[model samples]
Target: MQSWLDVDPTSDFSIYNLPFGVFETRDRAPRAGIAIGDYIVDLAVLAERRLLPLPDHAPHREEDLQRALNRPTLNDFIALSKSVTGAVRLCVQQLLMASSRDAHPPEVWAHALVRQRDARMLMPLRVPNYTDFYSSLHHATNVGAMFRDPKTPLLPNWRHLPVAYHGRASSIVVSGAPIRRPRGQIKRDDDPTPTFGPTLALDFELEMAFVIGKASPLGRPITTSEAEQYIFGLLLFNDWSARDIQKWEYQPLGPFLGKNFASTISPWIVTLEALDPFRVPMPSQEPPPLPYLRASGNQSFDIHLAVDLIAPSGLTLTVCRSNFRHMYWTMSQQLAHHTVNGCNVEVGDLMASGTLSGPTPESYGSMLELTWNGRNPLRLPDGSTRTFLEDGDAVALRGWAERDGMRVGFGEARAQILPALDGEA
Candidate 1:
């Protein structure tokens, strides 16, 4: 589909991928925006002009629809039915088409379109809850070999169910935010006693997270076949980790201070409808999962994932190249398992596919696996080496799927690491 605007075919936000986010200009407040190439289509202005599909599934009053899009987050707008949001997406796509240029007034187009560079993209939603799942077999196997018996890498229950933990939704931030190195209890392999200080091993986990568009009642399980109805879209996620703290605190219980420090996500949420063409069959699961977790048809996306690290010296390096298709467990399975015990989910809740490491050294997702737990260091182009992140280092995660000359992507989830605070935590 050709847009009237000059959208580079190689741009992540091509006409085929109109991702949604919240943005604000100097004179405007936070409002809903649709990204296409280099511009942000303002939903508030479109609603005010009656160009968008308002009142069809939303408030009857056009002003009310405008007000809803003018909010600080997309949660309220997403709480509406999928048909409503789907209509909005289709309407915007139609308006941007080259053939439809003469159908709309120039004044209306001028007011509704804004360059992305002129606006600030904010967090797309207010997350009610966040769940992080260890669904990548390679990542789990690598971690197990490093810490557990190499002969028996996976735990007894791994192949049966998706292992996951509830993460801190409050700490999640939008891209370009700075991540402060967490200060916590650290006890190395040789240290007799645990000490409290800045983490010696700080890492970033490359992940893809899905947003829940609809809510489910408590005490009811969202079956595998029904899980997709609740999922809204996907976002690139960077779940930061403090490996030293994780090793010390994660025992009978799961991670605590080791995680929950901070995580970064791309501002835009790419809708599943935009990514439908790139769907692929999920990897076959051995020892077939229970009925509740069994899913039919294509359950995986062929999204290519990569991670780049910028050193303090200003050199950038591609440290990891992985794929979402390598995940052993699918989103359907994760959501089904999560609610099988009666855990209710809310709109805007996030569920992340844990580190998506592939079957190679360069495909490892986290520094823990890439550097083999700080033993093997990655040498950068500037001759500097990195086992884990240091102060002023920046990490960015990018994901995309392409076929038939079309690309749908999550632009970037980038963040710089800041020095620890003056005092200790």
Candidate 2:
């Protein structure tokens, strides 16, 4: 996996790494690109040049990648097996390596390829469905302690299963998109009546999302061992919530509009193969999971994740710091539980590891837990107190895995809050 290019061995773009994404230039439509150094290797141009050794039976064409990116679905591209992805990566690496005798000159590829700074990156895949799981034991326990007694920090079934709820895919946007303040019904604990208006308690949940690359038949279940083959990559996810709205509506069923507003994800999808170096042992369970959810080997990655809050005045504070290893249930276990009932999962479906909090107060993932459900306010650098997000405030999430001499990053996911709309009673 040697490259003649002067790519830093410490960089994310080693010859062994090929992460996928979608980008649009000022003139072109959204299309697939592979990260190589500071530039983006445009897949459409490479396919047109016949540089990639794609199988004859493969359904993808140069045009398909471009069109699929513009549409709302990434199923066609994700369905490609690992063999095809490997071939594409090898070809791109050879084309970029200067020492390869058969390689084309840099000038030839430069005209079609674009610098990452000049391109507008979009969500790598069009997700048809999304499910968020409460997989972090520390997050669940900390939150439970605030609302319930400390002795009953965890629900009885928390250890036995991966608790999850369906999420809205249409509201999921790529990083940098503005999150509009959602209007909802809010009831005060001491007030006699409820009021309808913009949400006052907005918060962000730091998590990771796994994209499904392969589909299962409608009536078939994917086993734990087979789940890895179906996974494509990982991205940083911010599951924004309206806490005040949620407190009023969450009763018999789970969240509704409170959780449906907007969720932001990082543009780049760091492939699972790229993260092999960071694999670590999962935490031991209090009560073991059922047979269907059990998995062997190191099931989680040691990804260092953090969240930063920036006010409109440019003051930034590092609020939460944690690792992906805190998750109680692994991605394989979540996938196994998802299909235990024979519910089919399609390509491009997203599974989010909800709120990755750790064991300490400094590592809490959301404002709800950090502020103790608004009982205490988070003091800011400007001497202001915040129970929830305010207009013009921005939230950013960053994650990476560093091992040996290489560092693989998921880039960053960021969003700024807009003032609530006017009129409309």
> For candidate 1, lDDT tens digit of each residue in 1-425?
89889998889998899999999999999999999999999998888777876544454555656676889999978876677788789999998899998997798878888999999989999999999999999999999999998999999999999999999999999999999989988887788999999998999999999999999999999999999999999999999999999999999899999999999999999999999999999989999998888886899999999999998777999999999999999999999999999999999999999999999999999999989998999999877888899999999999999999999989999999999998855
Q: Give lDDT for model 1.
A: 0.92
Q: Count the backbone clashes (under 3 Å) in each candidate.
A: 0, 0
**Residue-wise lDDT of candidate 2 within 1-425, one digit each (tens)?**
56555567656556556678888898867777888667787876767665676666766665654444344334566676665665666677677666683467666676656888899988777788999999999889987887787889988889999999999999999999999999988999998988999999999999999999888899788888899998988999999999999988888798888999899999888888888888999788767778888786898999999999999998999999999999989999999899989999988899999999998988999999889888889999889988899999999999978877677887789999999899766
Candidate 1: RMSD to truth: 1.3
List CA RMSD, all candidates. Answer: 1.3, 2.4
Model 2 per-residue lDDT at 187: 94
Per lDDT, the best of the predicted structures is 1
Backbone clash total for model 1 is: 0
